[model samples]
Target: MLKNKLATLLIYLVAVLITVTFICILADIIIHGFSQISWGYLTESPSDAGRAGGIAPIIVSTALIVFLAIIIAAPLGLATAILLTEFAQQKTIFAGFVERCLDVLASVPSIVFGLFGNAFFSLYLGLGFSILSGGLTLACMVLPILIRTAVEGLRATPDDYRFSAAALGITRTTALVHLLLPTAMPAIVAGLILGIGRAMAETAALIFTSGYVDRMPDSVFDSGRSLSIHIYDLSMNVAGGDSKAHAAALVLIVMLLIINAISMGLAKHWQKNRIISNEIII
Candidate 1:
């Protein structure tokens, strides 16, 4: 009993420490950076190599790149998750192999992915330095995360649900579309938020695939600069760029928090609606 109590205390202490550290960091950034933000800063193009211009183009590019990546990855990841959880037997060799590949892939460093994107998407695919190349590279990086999380969510569905559907003569396709997918939506959204956060924060990968052109891109095929790359350039390359960098970082953090909030809100609404529908049917 005493050992168990000590272990619980230790875990609580560690959790508190992590929370406090995050709060401190976030507070510091906001305090130092919030003052630098202004409407003009958000709407105008940068001058003096990011020392004087707003991040309008960078924000637009970031949105397009992350949106493109999710659009490409989400369907592929969902289908793969359904295959693993619904069709393939848990003990099968193919499932095991695929899981192993995902595990290895999730461990790969971002820089390596950047290099691969440059070599394949930029050069081989003739995409050149463009938002499309960056988006595709991020999709590859995000796939493992989306698939694994979705698989877990699907597997967590009570076996009774499946049995009930079978007894009701519901087709597997209908069941997956109407039941399983909705039930697992929360986990899928969580994975998506994480993937978007990573994609938004990425610097090296965008540098190679998207290029550093700060001008507003005419199309996905045009070279663009993401906010992350702009932050990096301002901080490391441009003199007197610290204030702008901090403001950019603060914007990045705020954007992530908003995405997380919106995703959770939608998930909760979905689950609540599902519950209401079931209660009515009964």
Candidate 2:
């Protein structure tokens, strides 16, 4: 009892420490960056290599990269998850090998992924330093996290769900589409939020794959810059760019929060619908 109480206290202490640190960082950004944020700042294009003017073009570039990344990753990740959890024999050697591969991929450094993207997508595939290359690189980086999370979510579903569907003479595909996916929506959304957050925060990968062009991209094939890359350039290369850097960081953080919130909301809504449907069936 005493040891358990001590562990609980320790956990609470760690939680409080993390909360305080995050709050402090946010406060610092708002303090230094709030003055730099304005309608014109968000709408105008940056000048003098991000030391002057605003970040409209950079924002557009970031949005395109992130959008393309998600559009590419989500369906592929979900399909992989379904295949692993629904079709694969869990105790087989092939399943074990696949899991190991995913684990290793998840642990790889982002910079290595950047180099691979530059070598393969940018050079070999002839995508050049463009949004498409960056998006594909981020999709590769995000896949392991999303697949692992979704597989676990599917695995956590009660076997009764499958048995009931089978007993009702429902096909596997129909059951997967209507039952398991909705039940696992929350966990899938959690993975998506994590993947998006990582993609948004990445600077090195974007710099290598997307190139540091702050001009608004006219197409996915056009070279672009991500918000994280902009923040890095401003802080590292531009003199007296602290305010803009802080402002950009704040925007990035806000974008991440918004995505997380929207994902969570959708997950909850889907889960609620699933529950209501189950009740009606009963």
Candidate 3:
């Protein structure tokens, strides 16, 4: 009992410390940077090498990249996860090998993905530095994370659920689509949120694949800038760019928070609906 009490106290302390730190960071960024945000600041294009203009173009580019990446990755990731959890035996050598590969892929440094993006997507593929290339790179980065989370989520579903479905004479594919996917909705949503967050803040990989052009792209093949790259360029290279850097940081943080809030809300709603449906089924 004494040891359990100590462990509980330690967990609480750690949680509080983390909560305080995150709050402090968000507060500091908003307090210092909110003043920089205005109608003109948000609507105007960046000028004078990104030191004097607004971030309208950057916002558009970021949106396009994120949209493209999600569109490319979500279906593929979900399908792969379904295959892993539904078809492959958990104890099998192939399944274990794939999981190990996923773990290693997830642990790879972002900078390495950047270089690979540069070498393959940007150069070999002849896409050059463009939104398409960047989005593809981000899709690659997000794939492992989403697959791992989704596989775990699917695995976490009670086997009784499958057993009951099997007994009902439902096909395996039908059961997967109707029951298992809904049951794993919350975890799948969480993985998507994490993947989006990672894609949003990534600078290095995008910088190599997506050219840092602070303008609206005519097409996916056209070069464009992202918010993360904008922040990096402003803070590291441009003179008198501190305010803009802070403002961009604030915007990025706010975007992530909003995405997380919406995704979590959807997850809760999905779980509630699932519970109601199951209760009705019984």
Model 2 lDDT tens row, 27-142? 99888888889999999999988888899988888878887888899998999888888988556777778788889999989999999999999999999999999999999999
Candidate 1 Cα deviation (angstroms), residue 54: 0.5
TM-score of 3: 0.88
Q: Model 1 — TM-score against the truth?
A: 0.88
Question: What lDDT score goes with residue 153 in model 1?
Answer: 85
lDDT measured at residue 159 in model 3 versus the true structure, 0 to 100 = 98
Q: Candidate 3 — which pairs collide? A: none
Q: Candidate 3 at 268: error in angstroms?
A: 2.7
lDDT of 1 by residue, 88-185 (tens): 86568988888889899898898999999999999999999999999999999999988988998899777877889999999989989988887887
Model 3 over residues 10-68: C-alpha lDDT tens digits?
99999999999999988998987899988888899989987777999899899899888
Worst 10 residues of 1 by lDDT: 89-98
Question: For residue 43, what is the lDDT in candidate 2?
Answer: 98
Q: What lDDT does the true structure give each of the candidates? A: 0.90, 0.89, 0.90
